[model samples]
Target: MQLLSVNLAAPHAADYTDSAGRVTGIDKRPVPHPVLVTAPGPKGTGGSGLAGDTIGDPRHHGGDDQAVYAFAREDLDAWAAELGRELPNGVFGENLTTSGFDVNSALVGERWRVGDAEDGPLLEVSCGRIPCRTFAGWLGERGWIRRFTQRAAPGAYLRVVEPGEVRAGDRVTVVSRPEHEVTVAFWFRAVTTEPELLGRMLAAGDALPEESRERALRRGA
Candidate 1:
């Protein structure tokens, strides 16, 4: 697979949620140069793992488990067709717009070597992105959260395992795939709609994000 674009967010004033007049970085755009990728510590202290990018709200958006976000160009096309509007590479707030990648179907903990074998950063699939009021407001779509949840195609959030530089057109290679059925799509469905599937998410093991893993543990995972 190829990295179609490397997107970075810019802070913009948006009064879309209870926090009136808050700045948000949901509208990310493609950049021209290579960007350094590294683990941004933890969620509370860390922001976007992409060197120049910053998380507007660290309270719920950025952390080690969600250091990077990836969305497939195919998925974006599907959404465009469904929404009857053109959706660009980074329109969905994803840092990486991937081509020919099945991002949603990736197994939790699956590893990818981005760029090259020797110099690329290694990334591990962590979890599916959950929709929030900020996202819904950014899209200006009615019942956006409900609609996104029903679609069950939320893009995958990944953690940086090895730090390196990444840029547009870089190749993405799957370094490893753990034996598991807990895919990004399935996990999103289980956590949002089918609480029954919560217990099964544990099969993903430590690759699963701490937040979801804890919930699964409470469910006797």
Candidate 2:
């Protein structure tokens, strides 16, 4: 797979009605990526860690943190054709847009080498689906959340193994790690929907990232 674009936007303020019949103004700040490092700040909204809860107030749900979305390059082109316009900025709602990669099919604990194969940060991916209403707002509908989950292409959360500059048109390759079999999607289900598999993922040890391991522990609780 290759990078289609790297995007960032300045935070802007907007108002919306809530599920609880309240109205509020949301200030969505921009960052290098859509993944949030924590629950607040530019990193808080998007930069690649966890799919923050998306259906509620973003500040409360943590603003789509660590969310990565992707579409086939061809699909993007087709979508552009139908819309009779180029895909709008932030329309894909992803920090990195990729071509020729099936991100959803990636296994949890799978590590990708995101640069020259010799020296690059190992991006270990974990989890899927950070559903929220803002996502629906981005998609122009409520059911898009369901469609996202059902499709389960919730792109993986990555941790920098060697932190280096990643640019557009970079190639992504799976550096074969034979020990783990679980994909981020599998762990997402195990931790969120199935308690049984949490221990199993932890036991897989080095195959899983430390942050993911901690989340699994919380889920098992």
Predicted structure 2: lDDT: 0.51
What TM-score would each prediction reach against the true structure?
0.96, 0.61
Model 1's TM-score against the true structure: 0.96
Q: Quote the positional error of residue 81 for candidate 2 in Å.
A: 10
* Model 2 Cα lDDT, one tens digit per residue, 1-221: 87665443333333333533343222122234333222222333433322331323443432222333333455546556755677643355554566787675666556677667554445655455465665566446446666655544455555444444455666888885546657666666665556677777775565554566887778677
Query: What lDDT score goes with residue 126 in model 1?
Result: 94
lDDT of 1 by residue, 84-198 (tens): 9999989999999999879999999999999986777999999999999889998988889999999999999999999999999999999899998999999998899998999
Name the best candidate (by lDDT): 1
List where candidate 2 sits over 4 angstroms from the true fold.
Answer: 16-90, 117-120, 191-221
